[model samples]
Target: MANKIISQRISPHLWFEHQAEEAAKFYTSIFPNSSIGRISHYTEAGHEIHGMPAGSVLTVEFTLDGQTFIALNGGPLFKFNEAISFLVNCQTQEEIDYYWDKLRAGGDPKADQCGWLKDKFGLSWQVAPVQIAEMLVDKDQERLSRVMNAVFRMKKLDLKAIEAAYGEPVGAK
Candidate 1:
């Protein structure tokens, strides 16, 4: 299982003060193509920690968007802030809306097209599309300026409004 583990994994570990397993399940349910993989506790059927009953979960591995994550029930040495975030590259407006609303279900948006928001777990994420970056650097200066102006004031990236700002076809330059 060593080779198999290394070959298909980029796991971002989360250290939860408590409820690592609960958080794992929460995340898996929210994201598409995700689920709980493995859950192991401190007190096994025939084992113990520090010669006492440490009945908490030692580790919980979860899969989200085909990516693996391991949450440890470590003591609260640190907590998640906005220091690290995940970027979701969306292809369509519908895709953008779905993730934006859901991911930010209990979170708030930051500034501009570079959308930043926190989940219920206080984990930050940036939900954007390739088109957004593309639009900003469009060949038409007027279109570029207008789109840039609009995004500077928006919490969520609006595709239709961006297109309207152009008022003409702007090639991806």
Candidate 2:
């Protein structure tokens, strides 16, 4: 007999210090088509090692914009950094602004650069225009250089500015 695999194909797991539920709720609220899933609570049997009271939330399964994620209340032994980030591909400047403003609330100001931001929980996010990817991979080197320069000088990506750089020269200003 073969064991049945009962799990998401690949879900990003987030570790937090007793705030997994709160963060999950906040994330689900911000992204459309998102919601909190089954929440698992700690049991008294593992209190000695886990150090958490019985009945407390241990893990929360949630969906953000259709992506599966499991938030674990695993204490503060670990912290989120820029090593891994969620890249949100925005189709318009409006979408960029919306996500940037919402996710940047209580975020680190220093991390707000190159379309990247660290949220209050220290999770990094990249709010970028979808067109930028298409432009960067374009065969035109002149356009690539212009887009690169424009992106370097930006915090939240502006679709119009990037598209403008696609045809203009480097120093055209």
Candidate 3:
């Protein structure tokens, strides 16, 4: 065992069968102020996996919300599922709608209220508005009930209905 290992303070590692570049581009585009760094590969690193194809971009580094992700093309022995998810604190109904529409292009959506949906790449995302926290945790049971009911009845969130249910103006204080 090597005594010196790389730093582990900042970055997530993502493994893909062959869509490393594609996924990196997709994620960087979806999130604001994000970008992908240089990508490279190794032909023979020794041991059993040696003589692997070179120039295939074995790794990639990208940033989303200033967080880094390293994508590796390690073949199809594994995959991504609902076990992990990224949450976006969307501000406008349009923002939530935008993500819901774009990310769900070839993915799936589950049951209501939680904003739990899968993106085209099988990655899960929580597309929610900033107001949901307040509505869910509100001391007024009636308001919370109304909000939950309103949420269950729709595919995409109807901000107006939620606000109406809450008896508060849209984007309330």
Candidate 4:
């Protein structure tokens, strides 16, 4: 068969010590329209540089919510940090709660703040309401401040609380 050209301009690549396949599977399971794509194994040809045993999983290509991603078993040379995070924009409280609960499982509870959580894989994710973007950019400074304050007070975002804050008058307790 002919080669399939990748239509995605850019794909996120995840580096894991040894759980590339596992992580891909976990993420694919959580997101709709997701699936595992390709699997590539290491060979003895580059054993010196890669250090992985021959026939070991080297990379796994997966898709999450229609976005393609590559997971590489690159060993402990690097680690995931909060410098980069995936923002999951949810349309409802249920959506936000679902993603927050699923992604935050076995994650660092302390790292959770303002809808941000570090998952079991050390990957940071922002589970937030889709309307938050508009709320933050609202023309009213007081409304924006209230919304931001509400956000700062919660780990898993509560859409109702945020909307209440947005509707509150300035200086109203």
Please name the candidate that would achieve the greatest TM-score relative to the true structure. Answer: 4
1 against 3, candidate with superior TM-score: 3
lDDT, candidate 2, 39-154, per-residue tens: 88999987878898899999888888878898999987899989999999987889999999999999898998889999988999999987776777777788789889999999
Cand. 2 TM to true fold: 0.90
lDDT of 1 by residue, 1-173 (tens): 21234245467998887778878877777678887776767764545333323676877878788888888876666788878888888877888898888777755444223466787766787887667777776677987788878776667777777667766544523
Show model 2 residue runs off by greater than 4 Å: 1-7, 168-173
On lDDT, who's better, 2 or 3?
A: 2
Query: lDDT score of model 3?
Result: 0.75
lDDT score, residue 103, model 3?
Answer: 74
Per-residue accuracy of model 3 over 93-167 as CA lDDT, tens digit each: 889888777777778655323577777666777788888877888888988898998888766676778888888
Query: RMSD (Cα, Å) of candidate 4?
Result: 3.7
Highest lDDT model number: 4
> Which window of 10 residues has the lowest lDDT sum in candidate 2?
1-10
What does the lDDT read for residue 2 in candidate 2?
16
* Candidate rank order under lDDT: 4, 2, 3, 1
The predicted structure with the larger TM-score, 1 or 2, is 2
Task: Choose 2 or 4, whichever is better by TM-score.
Answer: 4
CA lDDT, every model vs. true structure: 0.72, 0.86, 0.75, 0.89
lDDT score of model 1? 0.72
